[model samples]
Target: MKYGVLEAATAAAIIATSVSLLYTPPEPSWETEVVANDTYGKFVEVDSYGSNVGIAYVDSIDTGLRLAEKSYSTSITDFSAQRKGNWDTQVIDNRSETGMYPSLESKSGQPSISYQDGDLGNEKLYYANRQNGEWNRTEVDNVVGGGTSVGMYSSLNFHQSKPVIFYHSPSQGLKMAEKKQEWSKEILEDGQGWYTETSKCGNTIKVAYTGRNSEQLKIGEYDGGWSSENTSTKIKSDLDIDTDQRCDEQLAYLDTETEQITYKDQDSRTFGDAFFTRLALTSKGNTTHLVYHDEGTGLKYAKKKDGEWTTKTIKQGSETGEYNDIEIDHIGNIHTAYTSQKKVYHTVYNKGTTQKIQSKTDEVKIGLGLISALLLIFTAIRQEVIAKIIQKIGEIQR
Candidate 1:
């Protein structure tokens, strides 16, 4: 199916769901489960029909929306919906592509979705709305520089009551975009460091990235406007090392009422290699957290409970590990995904239980295969003894 047709059908379904709820409301239910994953530079959107739903990612070669559909447990039908490129193409020419990074976030309280088209030359951000079974997309910003890494290389979030974008600009440092009449303005500009990580809660934006001169990891928060830029408190710790780069970080508010930012920091332990490090706020708007790692003794968790930096390893493992991602759900559940020994793992902290999910199916299969081999060896030995008895009888007859 073409991209346009798939979106049209989805929009129709959404409209149907909305209308049905208005007329006869009942318990909330999920109509379908759709999974989107990228394979070989193509965005594959698979629907519940157990078939390939032909939805393509918008780019220069394949512009606009495409779609396909399948039935419940039935084979997917080879039908599609597509919309050809017919928008303001003169805005930017995204030809010399270095890297294309796409980030998607749904607008709060509205049926609108925003995505960033990060290309080498024409780096642009866009917002699209689904109204009455049609999609209307509008360009929000056209970032200059063919080499600048714009858009969400780290994280993207929608702040309630205000539409703001927290992203890293190669030249503009850590920047924030506020919704304006047509285009947004860059609110925070730090000359010392380049912003590498960002997350938003309400109107506050927390950023973690490498700093200038020393290249140390720094965390900052933005609120109201640029006047709040100086209010960002830097976390201090003895675990901090020079020449270390913050690869990835995630921020979440500890308490929704207090609006405190609790973030995880990944720092380079070696001169060239990096490891996972935990940090938390000591006080409201204060910098630094209790810091520790798992490789030393036990599971490590650091927190700034009152007004001092504390460090303690909470859970310890023999092997070294690094945190890949961290998310705090609506119910104060901390979900952390990490990597250990080239295997992806997840740990969820909720209701005082830490459930560890690991990828060890391959090892289990190998153990079963070894046991089967031993059984086969025992059967073959019995057959050999029977053959030897038959040979002795033939010798007596000769």
Candidate 2:
């Protein structure tokens, strides 16, 4: 009877221990925070300027969606009021408007500001500087046709210690213009032929966009001259080629490590549901990190640590949202902002801690399950022994 009672108590204890282990609350972890309102738009740059960090976005305001700036520290402030409007607006208004707005580029070592002028066309580039809490605008490129259409893209690269702007004109293919000797030179004469997205890594320029007749993502390298390659093996019809296919591509580098490009391709009917591709290539002293986004899966990242594409998903599901802008700081920290359900959200990945925790949780769950099974087997053996003893005792008593 005593042996049976002890066995029963052991089983109860094992069951209770298993229940406690399984029901414990998960440890809290860092999660992406919704920093702004539910607005559909683009967040161009998050500049760590002045005494705090300033975020810039190009979205609809009173006179339609224009570029705006907001400053945040421990507190958030609308610095947009200090600026008249976005760079596009200033160019449209003939550069007469004043105040702080958004600019494609800012003069280095100056309080960042947006510039605009009437002499500039709809496609204009301006250099802005802030003096004594006020903004000064200067026209960097008076040339016409630099801006991309809505949902399209363009980029400015400070290559070889010179500012070069690469953009797609409506009918012109990919064009490269260098700001040298206070004069601009159109290097790529065959400008508007294929879709093009350009980014700079150190001194290397990486351009990726779709081809004129094919859906493949065409990539180009600019060292001394322009050399091109196709990153995607799929055909042109397999991808979603925009009206002006030349402008739909996106390109960016991962920190200062290496250049990478991410763009949309529609291989199947499932492709149109996915619109944006965020890619990053990072080289640790010389390592490459490639990250991309697909409609089927939200955010996918790849790394070249030992010299292969080691890929993983950062986020999954459409609920995570789309239209992501990724930036890697000097210290190799990644910050991404995207629109999910019409709301702007920001997420930062710090040294892969999130990845480590997820791995541990998976392993722990498996280990717990195995332990529970072992306990169950032991409990069964004990119960069987107890039953045998009880039977023997009854026999003896009879």
Candidate 3:
């Protein structure tokens, strides 16, 4: 009777501890830790090479675009005279509007950019490359709008040692250009392409664009003819590429090979407004990293690994993630740049960080672990007693 009571008590104690621990709230896995700042962003973009991270942004006062180039190894050594921090600043155009739609990438470990020459009547697309310590600006294409300004969005990528660009013009809908000493142009679509983005994902060209209405989100490829990879049309989504593909904008990734589009964060609600809600993507191998802000959810990051998507909140303070951009290094580390409270800040993914979670599955796992341990202990103790009792019974029978 005493042994039975003791075993029951042991089991109960284990169960109670397991329950309590399981119920304990998970520690917050993230905090809004800023790495650098003072660079303003109306349109902020972040990208990385190996471990080096760079940012490009444009503010109202920027006659030219701004570049913030820093590495995880070095401190802010040289501060930009324009920006308060130590960023390698470049006077991209100095002409008014040249810096309006700034986008960035790394080439051979140096920064390259594509921006609209937003100088009034010359709303053309320009590519800026740095070679031998000088920025050589090339006019990729001239959008004919006669000064009304149409190249509002421009994205850049490199494929096969050549530059690929995507931009929008009122006359040209969504246009893509490739540079090989000279530029070749093609129009992906006819309507206005709002917030269009293009990138090189392992030789595959992925273009993500919002429509003129700012509601529709569409992804496609820029091959011989532009092929629709995926589309998201919400109740009010502005762009319509497909009648079947449906969802709100939170996170969307394009798998170039399979032409599969994975959309995530549909449960998000706009607490107020996801103003400047932009998404940026960078890929490493089969995994793609996406960063964007949901109206109510603040800044969020996600990566598709082994065909599953897992997301984590970088900031929960509402209305953040605006103009958010993300990059992953060759080593698979993640870096992000975003705007909040009128300031531009940067953050990186820390695997050591504990993520706060309240999950039923977690509780079940804890409970199961305790039960398994208890069962092992009980079986070991009973094995000897059971053998002795069986032997005594045999003796009596004899």
Candidate 4:
């Protein structure tokens, strides 16, 4: 009977210790603020330049290309009247039917964007770059003959410190535009492309897209020259492609008619339901992060680290994350710009906030551990096992 009592006491002590160790408080909430609003955000693309973040999107109501620049500061009081953080917004191009599929990036600390000039009769590709604190817009490509449409799904990146853009022409399939002293255009592949995403790692540049006519997913890689490889993966909507420092390419896309966000690196994994999905990678730990929108929930983020995948909800709303973009800075800070209810928002995942919260949680856990141990010792005395502990102590002394 005494042994049974001692056994019960031991089980209670183990359970108490387990509960204290397993307890985890949630992380700090995301710092989010409006960047632009009022039916102006569509096809948003975000990129990080040093400690600053830049966003380019289409203004649906005004039909223009808009840009928002915000420098990240840890203190919320850094800016006047800041909710999270305020952005300096401007209209880079207000031409009619322009800014569809704006892709933003930075090279040599200057932000630039490549987008489509969507005027039906003068359909063309446009490039805009910030020079001397001013935005200079230039016409990149316009193969306007026999009803050819160019620059619908544009993707921009830098190669060897030069700006390169991958886009699709309805009559010419897949194309690339590179500016070397002057802007030049070339055909990468032959197929009506739906979505085009480009990334450059080391000496290799890769472009991933889908065929509009066949609905097939394909990737084209360029080391010295262009080469094509086909994938059996068929996406239900647009997709994002990125490469880590190790040059491991990843693809994140809306799969099965937007029922889920599917990520493919070496293998594929699906994370619930999502609408517009965007992907970014951090070289710090080779972490692949994705920002996406659920149908009824809100904006969500998922990341894979150390072979395990974890997700967190950024914000809650039925219409949040409808159109979104994700970018990671040099220090591993995640910046996301998304549109919810037609208003564009910028959210940051502050690592310092998470670390402080974790430190407090660790202190709480240590206190709980001590308390649990004391309670178990008291239970041992009540169960008459105090004598046994005393005897063990005495034996150890001998």
Candidate 5:
């Protein structure tokens, strides 16, 4: 009675089909989608298990990552709750410099975030967490460490049910902190806009950064001591990075099993005018998803799905995909959060699991729902229609 791991995207569909029949769209389509133009949504991040999906992104003008969530079984539509801090109104350091480059990770059913805050240019890192319906804030590091520049651009992830962050300090280059009884920090080397990839074994914490002195890209493995090297030519000045994601010259990947960093073959695999990179290694450890931009191509997605490398363009406009983040849901659906045309769009590929068949009865409900939704377009009432649709189909399938 139970299925094994999902080796193929189609295999996951088999599990879905077993649960209930589906109507696969003839071509790729945005079944349920939304884009927000009013808010400044740069550096977007999303995580989900089943129906519970959470999103965090920077409202640059608002000075922090806006948090939202949707906890429904069937609908793949807009967020149900936006800016959901009402559980507690706890505020963190809200200076002029506090809002940039926020990172988010959801674990143990709660989302934890990290960001940089300070006066003018004197920056320090801080963490905010919500649990048991209370939002709390803490300072992970102080500015007194001394730096070549301010310590900013943080990546937050959960390792062994504990909080860990990889952050950049101009004085220290690349640094990492893990939350235990208190926060413990480590200085690995000197670099900027570094990416953190923790091994599945959890014994090793791997990092990749834009090399400063050599101008080359570098990578290292940290486990209570030093292990890293600068092994390639200098990278271009233009680079972008996100959680476990960085794209630049002297490219590389980490072999977590062996705890070694493998440099990519740049001679063959290359890009031009690389902007930003969003990376996601699937929980299965078999596939890797990367979304990035180039001068020639606007926004692109590359994935090594099922041992084959394939790529497609997600956005074709100029200067798109500047700050992007990606996450895979319970099923093998791929969802991306990227800024294009100065607006943040959530591209959903919800073909297999979240998306379901359009039965005759279901289509009628959807048709009627659309009529009601149109009357309430651009208003809060539309969200109510979406909820009914989700409940309608959820009950039908059950």
Candidate 6:
């Protein structure tokens, strides 16, 4: 005598109920802090050096460029990893409507920022560096006349210890400004250079940007000289680029037509799925990490290692991951800055298994394991009962 279909269905229902009652999802293993509040972080960039993390962002309330710096303790003995010492905020530039689209980098434990001036008739590019307890500002480039903007899409990096900035010019195309003695400028492409991102590997400085005419992806490499090439990939809203120690380029971009987050390396391999604009990317050796906004599921952190991609949601909200920036520290911790509801937030992911929080996928796996074990036991008991019934019947017949 075997179990009927209704009995099987009831057993499945019981197993499901048992799993639901017995298993609990682990808590998220990340911590977040509010860096700024109430429209202070419109456009942001984050960078880390040693134990210090710095964020540069546009404070829309004061219409200024702001810097937020915090130092984190890396000791895991006390479980006090999220103890980011008080975030100190400083006004880098507060003139009339400045500091839109800022790129920040930490050099020698100090923050250096490149930004766009938003004042009317002063759509200029500016750089600010902190030294001796004060900030020194320099005008890197400016529009000669009144009708054009020159620095909105600026990407800043250091090449040979000198600051090099790649920026967009509405009338002039893609341009680069290098600060050796005085700021010298050169035009890379005549009618291109939108949404530029820059990274350095030894003496090589690479920039990834969007072409103005075709709206496609383009790469500009600067070793001894500048050379430009076009890629078949199209750019939609935003993109980021980084380089590993091997000088291999790791790039992530928003696809023009699909609105998907597409990643590519020097070898031209691609990964990722549908996501919204404004992502940040960083790489170390064979591991690449990205933080992007998913239109359906909020903010996500994705990692690609050994040719496989594993992604997890960092925060869940409609507008959480917009305007995000990511950085990897020397010891392999991940730090990110993002904006949600017009406020800036900082989050960190520390490496190691010290934290016991499991992801949602892990919870599902645990539930499935429980169900499988229970189903095996139910089948084994049912078969034993059937064997006993047949034995009794055969004994009576004898």
Give the TM-scores of the predictions, in the order they appear. Answer: 0.38, 0.50, 0.62, 0.77, 0.65, 0.78
How does residue 282 of candidate 3 score in lDDT? Answer: 54
lDDT of all predictions: 0.36, 0.44, 0.60, 0.76, 0.55, 0.79
**Clashes in predicted model 2:** 24
**What is the number of residue pairs that collide in model 3?**
9
lDDT of 3 by residue, 79-129 (tens): 111123454555656665666677787788777898877766767778898
* Superposed Cα deviation of residue 237, candidate 3 (Å): 7.7
- Stretches off by above 4 angstroms in model 1 are 1-118, 125-139, 143-147, 152-160, 190-203, 206-208, 212-221, 228-323, 337-398
Backbone clash count for every predicted candidate, in the order shown:
29, 24, 9, 0, 6, 0
Candidate 6 lDDT, 96-128, residue by residue in tens: 678887889867877788988877666899989
- For model 2, where is the 10-residue window of minimal lDDT? 73-82
Candidate numbers, best TM-score first, in rank order: 6, 4, 5, 3, 2, 1
Could you tell me the lDDT of residue 189 within candidate 5? 67
Structure candidate 5, residue pairs in collision: 23-357, 147-171, 148-170, 148-171, 173-190, 173-191
| Candidate 6 weakest lDDT stretch, 10 residues | 352-361
lDDT of each residue in 281-363, candidate 5, tens digit only: 33234556666665556766666645566777887777677666677766556777777765766666654433343333356
- Candidate 2 local lDDT, 1-398, one digit each (tens): 35564566566657655764665323322235554565434333443333223344433332212233332222112211112222221111222322112324333533343322222244444544456655555465434444432112345556776666554444455666665687364535343323344555555776655544444456666775778765534322111121112322232322111122323222111112334443333334333444445567675555544434455566676645344544443434345555556555555544333334445656766676666676677777877898999999999999
- Please give the lDDT score at residue 32 for candidate 4: 78
- The alpha-carbon lDDT assigned to residue 55 of candidate 1 equals 24
Off by over 4 Å in 3: 1-40, 73-87, 143-147, 213-218, 228-276, 282-288, 303-311, 316-318, 350-398
Task: Report model 1's TM-score to 2 decimal places.
Answer: 0.38
Q: Between the candidate structures 1 and 4, which one is better when assessed by lDDT?
A: 4
